[model samples]
Target: MTAPILEIRNLSKAFGPIQALNNVSLIIPRASLTIIAGPDGSGKSTLLKCLLGLVRADAGQIYLKGQLTDKNFEQIRSISAYMSERFSLYPDLTVEENLDFYACIQMVPKDRKDDLKHRLLERTGLESFRFRLAANLSGGLKQKLALATALLSSPEILFLDEPTPGIDPTSRLEFFRLLEELKKEGRTIILTTPYLDEAEKGDEIVFFHRGKIIKQGSLSDLKNQFPLLVFSFEPETNIFEAYTELSKLVGPENLILRGRQLKIFVPEGEELIWRGKLLRLKREEPRLEDIYFYFERRSEMMELGHDQ
Candidate 1:
């Protein structure tokens, strides 16, 4: 509210006949952990690149600190750290070597270098692997080193592209632990992930679909906007047949199959008969995945997506 740290205005981009991004606008409050979620090829990467000026927008404006200038582009680049889904890390270089080289290039001072390196490695849990060549590390450890390198200069804003996609779940948990530390240090973090369940972790979230923002708000705010409640069912017979039959009563558009069970949104007053037919039905807590899928289906039914 007090002048967003990052402001995007009417951003648009296209790749030939396919529009990679439509007119999109968003504001990232200072020191917020913002998560961007979308299906594959929905323009998540393009949006990040456009915001960072790595990819120019066809028509839009990006303002940082209330200042906009094409000439000082590199200066804006300096205040941010980026790690792509396929991050660039030298396979042959030792983890320590990569950190030292990155620090030197970023002009991190010698007097503070050791302290900074130790802190990052400790935070990312890469301290023991520092002497190991990056190529020799496991997928999860390599990701930690790549993230550590990005943190070398302690940029005020961090941009990541699914940095934990292939890493083990434990490693992904550790990665977010590092981000939690950054949050305490007052760093603004924004990243994109296809995993819908992770959306609940952010202070604010923007949902990207078909190159536009369908929803953006704090998790509680977004969840409150939906007028649906979830009911879970466990079948005594075939789960598939039960789901198939229940799909008719509840409408396939509103059901999400999870394992042998399903989470359904039962419209108010349209529930008695449906509840009577179910072998076992219970009210359940609504997870972020439920919230995301509900809107995605709603958007499809509306035949329109929300953006700027």
Candidate 2:
């Protein structure tokens, strides 16, 4: 059996009184896209920073490439590139110049800089906009340029924090396509995003909430293991009013609003009760979002039980 490319064991971190990560452990395979997904302050970014040695964990061990080294961070940083939530590019620099600058920073040899720069430009589809100033580029193009810079070093592992937040859907799709290309080139990519739909594109997903991993698995594995039956329906009354009324009847955790449609998760044999209250009801397959919330609510209930 092949070993995991990266292994994190019993990782934990804290900030003053707040615990940022709690006994987190994960295994990442080579050449795969692993998404760390959760809401804001869920410790997704903290996990990435700890792995890259930007933030020190209070406890736990990180192993890379089947070995744990004394200079763990130094070795990891050498083979990794991180693009933070606020990836900065020189606004005044043209796209080509920006790439050139990062290439120099990554210490790409003088003899190979131009070839590497050109390849990245072509790969990111930024060759035509090479001469355009970074500040003038659209949000999506700006993100592409940031990715190009991160790739300048040809690092084996890429870490991205919320790389697609607020971008247009078209650009987000383009960015994901580039990631697929990188995976084909045998690069391990670990990223964090708040969007559950975006997390669907990952080879594996780790779901975090309030500094703990609630669940982790491949998309299909998660879907297959989901225990509840889901149904979508249109409420007969005003959507907001129906949601409020239904929350009292079925508990808020079981209900979700998707535009004008309502999605509810119920245990076995409880579908008929909800069906009577909603219109146009139909059984639906569970999505990533549904699975996430299911686990999240379970976690909350477990914690609540313990507290009581």
Q: What tens-digit string does per-residue lDDT give for candidate 2 at 229-283?
A: 8888787679999788777777777888889988888776764444354334588
Off by over 4 Å in 1: 69-72, 234-250, 272-281, 304-308
Worst 10 residues of 2 by lDDT: 271-280
Candidate 1: how large is its RMSD?
A: 3.2
Off by over 4 Å in 2: 69-71, 237-252, 257-261, 269-271, 274-281
CA lDDT, candidate 2, residue 90: 94
**Pairs with backbone N, CA or C atoms under 3 Å apart (clashes), candidate 1:** none
* Candidate 2: residue 256 lDDT (0-100): 85
Clashes, model 1? 0
**RMSD to true structure for each model, in Å:** 3.2, 2.5
